[model samples]
Target: MSPACFYGDSSALDSILGISRKKTEGALGQHPPSVSYVKAEQDDLLGLQPDEPANPKVLRVAIIGAPNAGKSTLSNTLLGRKVFPVSSKVHTTRCKAYGVITEDDTQLIILDTPGLTSPTKAKRHNLDRSLIQDPWDSMKHADLVLVLVDVSERWAHTCLSSQVLQCLSRFPQIPSILVMNKVDLLKKKALLLDLVTELTEGVVNGKKLHVKSLSRTHLDPARNNPLPSIPACTPENAPKDGGCLQEGSEVQRGPGSDTSCDAKASDSGHVLGGTEKAQTATPQVSRDGKIKKGWPHFREIFMLAALNGEAVETLKRYLLMQAKPGRWEYHSKVLTSQSPQEICENIIRGKLLEYLPQEVPYMVLQETELWEEGPSGELTILQNLLVPKETHVKMLIGVGGQLVSRVAREAGEELMNVFLCDIHLKLCVKLKK
Candidate 1:
């Protein structure tokens, strides 16, 4: 069949597109600044100043974890808006996206990054370079790091992903938190405690105690045996020489200077490097400098379901409280750094990922053909979905074009909600060649 085309109509398109519908008296064809710019300008005209606190605060948090670990969901929940795209497919976020939350004198900037993957796996799959570098870059600029783990997954109960371990080990200086996401899916509450114990290696509430062997049977002898008691590395007991003390090695550093620690060999013979200052509790590292268990240095542990937004507020409050005195980087009205076109593309991509079958969505490329304002203050958008193979185009269009239609309709509704205006969206599926 020929390429299928679908159209979406909604009322709030002009607002979302940052276009001004009201005409001024003096100039012809002179459009006003965007809504955000106008609002800021109005504030200036009215002499409206923020009630600045004694110490205005800002916190930049980087959320990192394995693929599909609810990082984007949590970020949207915290921001109280769905600016980030989310789907069941892994690597839905191709690069680092920023979400902003401003309350009173505090502004929290969330760095929603692409999921972490090993270098080999990334190269083998020919994934985007951002998938490997973005997380580290986010960590370098972050004041705090949230390590989100999908607790419902069985793999989480055994050990954290190697990529997660690498992140924790690399940026030991930044205060990190352990967020056990998707807790609502886990039925047995007792197993949650066991999983925590196993991950934390019997360290709870800043106290170290002997934890019995986990009830779950595992083939790895290292996990089955009782782990040795390692002193919890807190800032109070950290090395006085302005560096983190790990077992026998001393990470030396000058005062107020950031330095990288030498690469240490892991128990598995992997060499992990790029170390920073150690400010929090250190994870249980192998003698050769590899992380063997969960990061014990997490200043806090939170359990929440990002999908339902349960306990997310509590986490948000905690992060807010952690903010220190700093100037706000973004205006309070700004929700994200993404442009309108980027947002629309992500929404459509998310829908395609949700509606299309395995590997098809990943293989599809999206291009915006046209974006213009209609006479009645509606947005008209035309986008194309380019598939590499003709068979893939058939799959995207579905029988009688039902699949593509569903993707278009749902995406339009979401776009309408996001823009708060009427939108006319057209989608066409075409062969890439």
Candidate 2:
């Protein structure tokens, strides 16, 4: 039997019952194993009967949100591999990259898209057109949409971004779910219930509901002291003092614990939609009958910390169960549609963003000088960093080229792990003008 098949196993039972088992510590951080692929026609050992049905199961999910909302982290976590590059900087993913996850008979094509920005912001920053266009384009072909929000960030926790709301309003037909990411950093556990009530407008899976309030006498201390207004970490405004927190990094202010609120709370007191009763309450609709603040039609709400893979298994299983009969798009062994060079470019760019100070990484451009493999099955990559300014070139190279050396070393290490082979990566900094 093929390794992908889980027939008669406990995993199969878990899938049926919607149970998610936490991954082991070793399994949580390990890279996916490399396997040789055989053509579907030539291989009949996929654990499928010869007379099986013609249609296979497939699902295309588009993860959309504001910049730095852990979209790439969630994508990598769901795929069980780090195919996409992630950093503290926003707009790290400049386009829509596809990551495929095939388990048994289901194939999940994840569209990791660029952050959604308004047209004015895009033009002001002279950003790539893809940053504004790709999110909508991804939704055009998506079977499901996941609107991710960084609940730990003060600016994003209370309300959805305007662009996100517009996207949800534009595509009312597509099924979307609100994914509240970074729950580990949310100090006040009680705020989760309020955040959910605000974002979903008290509607979960088409049902109007309310959250049972905690006793005023027993108010949580953390609730009294809310998180400070720290702007969402983006490339233009990333702290120069190295104060920005990256994904998976812990904050010293609070204890990290998994918290979730059930939608089946009492139907009384301070209805979210401002009605006296839950049954009579409804989402805030505009004059054209479209949602105004948050999406009311979210099919489900998932609270997860994508950085450490917490609660991610449940979301993955839920997505697998949502798959319907369709033709498979790619081979089972394929994890991503990005080519080696593209992957390399993204990884290098991510490292540059991570190590370099504000605005330097974004200003630098990459060019492939050479890509070759050795006789011993190792890879050699020569890439150039093109900077517009002489000072920028110096910044990239650093004193005695220490900075660039670190970027190359760390990037090559990650590349070796990703491709499962030794890599000789050389980087050169050049002045473009």
Candidate 3:
């Protein structure tokens, strides 16, 4: 009498039908162009049962970094598709989203979370508060962390944000990989070597990491064109990113290397003691004036351009190989867990960021009003762009409404590609009271 073991719901009809699946063929047995219904008993509902065998391995990786550090770009690249919206502005990602990678014997679940930044008193919207806390929330569920660093920046070595250092310090138990992103932008090859050496030695907070170096200089075998070369490009043959995706070999786990970090005591630093409180707050700075002592030891290091699909394949393979045996948390075929509405919101906001002036991007907000699906695989989306000032609205509208038209066109085109249907995107510019 255990409620008759209702899997999804106890509805009598669903219980009798077991599981209902939809098919493309018509219910009337029509060929080539209609839809139909199918019913099947799936053991997948409860996942692998205790008595059942054949359980595959699963790995959950969390990608965290500073705002505009190419985290969304890297997440899209690793997922081999564009689900997370990408833009040049900060705070592009407002929540944690999953990008699933299904392989033969493993499934890699990637959590793409908002960039870690300190909460500000002025920007205290619910969304802003969520953005600051989402990364730490996702960290609790991660098996491993991929820390992406913007290596192309001039202050890349010493200008590590205090927020990032605090995050790394808080999670000393979880193993992390240091990913040096945007290496292709380096004009000089020697600078890469110097940067790597300095990064390995640079003390953060106060602890110096014993970093193991396995640096690969080349983005790909085709140095000039890092993206994998495709045989041809046609309407039917083109890949998502204008080329084939690069697939690299996984890094084999070797004997334990000494990558452990030690805690130090100072006016602002805390000593490494288990559950023992220090008398004085650990001064984040050491004698050398390093910011904090809670630096994390990176188990693996990778340098690649996520935009160009460099070394991304290697990163994927490594994650797959690192998978520990367990029940998969998500379905194999599900690329993203974001709803259609959420996807549209991100896309529209991203487009707005791209076309608007720097000052105007932050002054604007987008919200989806309505979503309707047409009979012929078409979509009608109604969204409103709210601006604080009428001047901002005027700017967004442009002369003769040209700027809004451009955004609609670009967003519709990308939407059509992802949803495989014509999109009618209606954007209204309204002044916020």
Candidate 4:
């Protein structure tokens, strides 16, 4: 068996139906029993990778970048959904977000990690345990890492981008892609290309500035009022500030013209390698009938570089090409895995069972467990909202259970859209407090 491939133990799966991990040869006899195992072909799990896996394989790719590098934009664009948040502001993405893209029922879970900065960004801000810690932990599960860099800005401002590339280069064997993100704003495109493909991408000392957070309204096209038609709004290719809008700002549509609502962005500018000035053309409709807008330089270039079959297909192939040796030995593909419905239900139930007051003094952290199906086409979620301090309990809980009611309604409504059905969410807080 190749280290990249996995052989699920369909034959000798043990059963522990008695609510515990006990000795049981009759495990296979249990009804609704779930047993799965994986076997790898290579004995040297950490040795040089095989050209082709000896057996079934599980490949992993992790997309990483510095904050505000268009990591979310590229991922969502690649995933073809608003799965991750893409905002002009820095740190809009607080943690790791996972989206499993499946084709013909075959699934690949793509993990989007928060920008890994030097000295780390966790030390600052009021980030709760759940808000960002998830991304940091994602590394342990990653097989390949896609490093993203916002080329539109100056290299001086990229705190850990160079360092990250340095860290990745050390592996040499852990296939990695250096993504030059936000290239739409750069004046010279070639300057960022070599590094983007071979190893790393960035202007050694190019000038770039840090961006500030904007009102949530900026990201939503419907909400942002148009820039003054007069062009004083500076219809530049990309905002110098990495796109957080300015005060009294006219519609600051950049080159890659987007006409979602009343506003319209200009077309994307071309970066034709070398010293040639970029060109901009009008947007056009694709043969598939979807309107295609211009992507800034780094994104546009990277898109072409990584294009294999289709965009998503390219990603699958790229990850597979980058898969390391013996990584599959640690993983298995099991049939009858938990479905989204089951996961959501478990999230609800766990929340209900762990109910606690918001003002609890001692308890610190909480995590959602499972979600169950509800009658009348509703969803019942299981989750635990944990807290570090157990002492602040009374203050967090108010009269008539007002907060608990509010929380249920809010969570229920959110889950309803994803589940494609009404939701009856339940909650609980488990706290040491």
- In order, what lDDT does every prediction score? 0.65, 0.69, 0.59, 0.38
lDDT of 1 by residue, 1-433 (tens): 2111000011011111111122213211222123221233334523444344677899999999999999999987787666688999888898998887777789888999998998898888778999999999999999999988887787655577878888888888888777778877775433444565566554433433232332233223665432221111222222333212122211222243222111111211111111223443556567886677676666556667899776575577668778889987766656677767777888899888888888789888999998777787677889999999999989999999999888888887767665666788889999998
Give the 10-residue window scoring lowest on summed lDDT in candidate 4.
11-20
lDDT agreement of model 4 with the native: 0.38
TM-score of 2: 0.76
Better of 2 and 3 by TM-score: 2
Q: What is the lDDT of residue 389 in candidate 3?
A: 94
Q: Highest TM-score: give the candidate number.
A: 2
- Give per-residue CA lDDT, model 4, range 1-433, as digits (tens): 3221010111000000000111223211222211111112122221323233354345555676666666656655444433344445455455565554322222345677666654444445444564345544665667666666555567532333444543443443444444444434554333332333222122111111111223344333764543211110111122433222223222222233212411111111111111112333222336874432211111111322221112233333434433333423222222122344433433333233334323232133445565555567565565556655444333334466566666567556534543446665655655544
Ranking by lDDT: 2, 1, 3, 4
Compute each candidate's TM-score over C-alphas: 0.72, 0.76, 0.67, 0.39
Q: Give the per-residue lDDT digits (tens) of candidate 3, residues 226-330.
A: 222112111122233222212221111113311121111011111111111112333355676455522425555566678877656556666776788988766
Tally clashing residue pairs in candidate 1.
10
Model 4 C-alpha RMSD vs. true structure (Å) is: 18.6
Residue-level lDDT for 337 in candidate 3: 65
> Which residue ranges in model 3 land beyond 4 Å of their true spot?
1-53, 120-127, 157-159, 202-296
Ten residues in a row with the worst lDDT in model 2?
Answer: 257-266
lDDT of 2 by residue, 337-384 (tens): 776777789999998988888878998889999888788878899999
